[model samples]
Target: KIQRQMGSSYHPEVTMKIQVPFEEFTLQIEGRADGVMETDEGTVIDEIKGVFKNLDAMKEPVQVHLAQAKCYAFIYGE
Candidate 1:
């Protein structure tokens, strides 16, 4: 439902595999986002989740969810 509202530009279940090379500690991040949308603005990662009636009770994003979104944004070079 969320994906539909975002528009057809958003592809469902987009997977991202990014590798960051460092001096010694290399980083490899891989995950599948609910969907990804691209526009004149930039790339947007959608991290969709369900929590029953709890969705209405929340006014702001959860810390972990926010962090995950940030990580995806970083990987996407947004």
Candidate 2:
């Protein structure tokens, strides 16, 4: 709904497979991002998270969320 106001464009439920070398084994990191947007600011990743509790109970997003967002950013080569 909110996306209509934003000039950004996105690909929803997008996934990418990347290989990382861990010692002698190749590690694969694969998952889907909520959405990836192309905006004037730059390529942005939209990671939608919902909290069940009251807004006050929520703190900042956890490290994992930030990391995941960045991983998606890397996948897009932005």
Candidate 3:
């Protein structure tokens, strides 16, 4: 639904694989971004999630969901 609205501006199902260094070793993270868009300012990583709650009542993004978006952002930034 939202994807249709975004149209050709967004590329769907972007696969990203990144390795992050921890204290002793590296951690490999791999995931697919819902959508990605390139704007004049910068690249935009779109992370879409389905919600059962009413949209009208929602005030903020879920922490885990936001984290997921950040992961994509980090992957792209690197």
Candidate 4:
């Protein structure tokens, strides 16, 4: 619903894969971002996570989930 309002700037279910250089090898990271948006400011990566508990009880995003979002952003930037 909200995606439709954003028009062409919003891309839903975007899959991204990227490789990063490590100490002596390369690391590959791949995942799907719920939505990616392009705006005057910059690119936005949206990651959706299902909650089984009260949302209010969560003070911060899960570390793994946050890492995935960061990976998506890095892939897009690359």
Ranking by TM-score: 4, 3, 2, 1
Query: Where is model 3 more than 4 Å wrong at Cα?
Result: 1-9
The candidate maximizing TM-score is 4
Candidate 1, residues 1-78, lDDT tens digits: the string is 766887878888877778888899888988888888998898878897766667678899888988888887887773
What TM-score against the true fold does each predicted structure earn?
Answer: 0.70, 0.73, 0.80, 0.81
Report how far off residue 42 is in candidate 4 (Å): 2.1
- Give lDDT per model, in order: 0.81, 0.76, 0.87, 0.87
Residues 1-78 of candidate 2: C-alpha lDDT, one tens digit per residue: 655655437667778668888999998888788877787788777788775778787677678878988787887783
| Residues 1-78, model 4: lDDT tens digits | 777887789999898998889999999878788899999999988898898989999999899998888888878888
**Local error of candidate 1 at 74, Å?**
1.2
Determine which window of 10 residues in candidate 1 has minimal summed lDDT.
Answer: 48-57
RMSD of each: 3.0, 2.7, 2.6, 1.9
Model 4 per-residue lDDT at 24: 97
What TM-score does candidate 1 reach?
0.70
Model 1: residues with Cα > 4 Å off, grouped in runs: 1-6
Report the poorest 10 consecutive residues by lDDT, candidate 4. Answer: 1-10
